[model samples]
Target: MEKLELTPPPAILFALEPLRAMADYVASLAPASQPLPQGDGHPVIVFPGLGVSGYATEGLRERLKELNYEVHDWEQGVNQWPDTEFDGFLDLLSEQLKRIHSQNGRPISLIGWSLGGVYARELAKTHPKLVRQAITLATPFADQPNSTHAGWLFTLLNGGVSPMDEALLRRLSIDPAVPCTSVYSPSDGVVGWAGCVGTESEYHRNIEVDNVSHWGMLHNPEVLRVVARLLAEHRRGTFRTLLDTCVTKLL
Candidate 1:
């Protein structure tokens, strides 16, 4: 099947992120989904999206904690350019992954939202032995980096795309060595959903939910259930489409 062309979401729709976020807050207060799988107490690191701080992912980390996974937030204050300072954030990320992997004595799971997903995928590829699986939320990992409304902002920050930008985009599109899951919604108000769901295979899969705007992917209750299922699937086997997800069923 031919993939849809990538484009920024409509301005009217994109403006609803705050509304969706509000809805997520209300929905998360009351559990609506059926029983979700509990985690095996493995470590999972969640990376925040571009231009945001770890506070944005606090709800997501809390939900994962309820599943019994050791969840940690990216310590870098506010997310900025990957190559910003201190030998770059990726290096910092690598060190953190190594420390966590060493202390836990088990591979860790990487979950990233939007730009954070870019980090999760890259780290998994670079250090598969240290990673059990990877999950991305509302991330545009496809080749067309300029497809989102905020794409230009990124370009401006990076001082225009260079060879490094091209290389990173190429790497982001590639699937990680470990099991990978992408949770996205067609109604996402930020990045286009087409690029959010990477290529699906035995180890790589996509879960599409309803009513989750790009910003809401972090706090959306349905998204939490999806993550819980994927994390629980680690012990049984690889993640697949037929995971009894409440995402499609309830959403």
Candidate 2:
């Protein structure tokens, strides 16, 4: 019998300077995780990763709601679903965000997983006024043209033929002014570790965790803690408590 080989997600090999910068930024922010008056009843739109369905993340969504966040799912089916084109993907996101604003009179927050993170960033950029903040889990901004193996396969699986080049990276990289948080692990089972790092810039924080696979991270308690912290800080204007917790854990 032939044994199957599991190719680990691409690792991030480099000095820790950039990661330290990200960590410091997160720590510097004040800690406050409370519901915002703006969010009143506005729903949070969640974008799941490739081949991931809402059912799989129901627990997480419910958990957030329990924390007082109104959670909404795209329900676009898993990565295996055939008709998932990029343009159509964007259209759906635009409509959903608009709908949330219309129904709740407030901007919505986006929590994107894997490839879905890319969409979340784009939506925030296009509708900055309507998107309060974006949380990307294990997403990347690879040199578009030289993106890692998984990115290429992802493109093939989804529709679209734009080469991963500097242009694409520049276009997709979230603006510095937009509040965005990227949660990633060096040991992810898919996507290169480098892709997870947020470029040295303002209002962008990258968090690196240990022992989380690309898929497993969606449910990792630590990751959830980080997400809850980020979202709460954004809506409530306090982040020091959580930052202190993370600092204590690191120490």
lDDT, candidate 1, 1-251, per-residue tens: 36778888878878888888788788888865588778899999999988889999998898789889999988877776665652366787899999988899988989999988988988888888888888899988884766787677677667776324566677678888678888889898889988887777767888898888888888777788778767776542354654445345545
Model 1, total clashes:
0
Off by over 4 Å in 1: 84-88, 159-164, 236-251
Best by TM-score: 1
What lDDT score goes with residue 83 in model 1? 58
Clashes of each: 0, 13
Instruction: Evaluate model 2: give its TM-score.
Output: 0.71
lDDT, residue 193, candidate 1 = 87
Per-residue CA lDDT of model 2 for 175-233, tens digit only, reads 42467777888766566667667653445666787766666656666677777666655
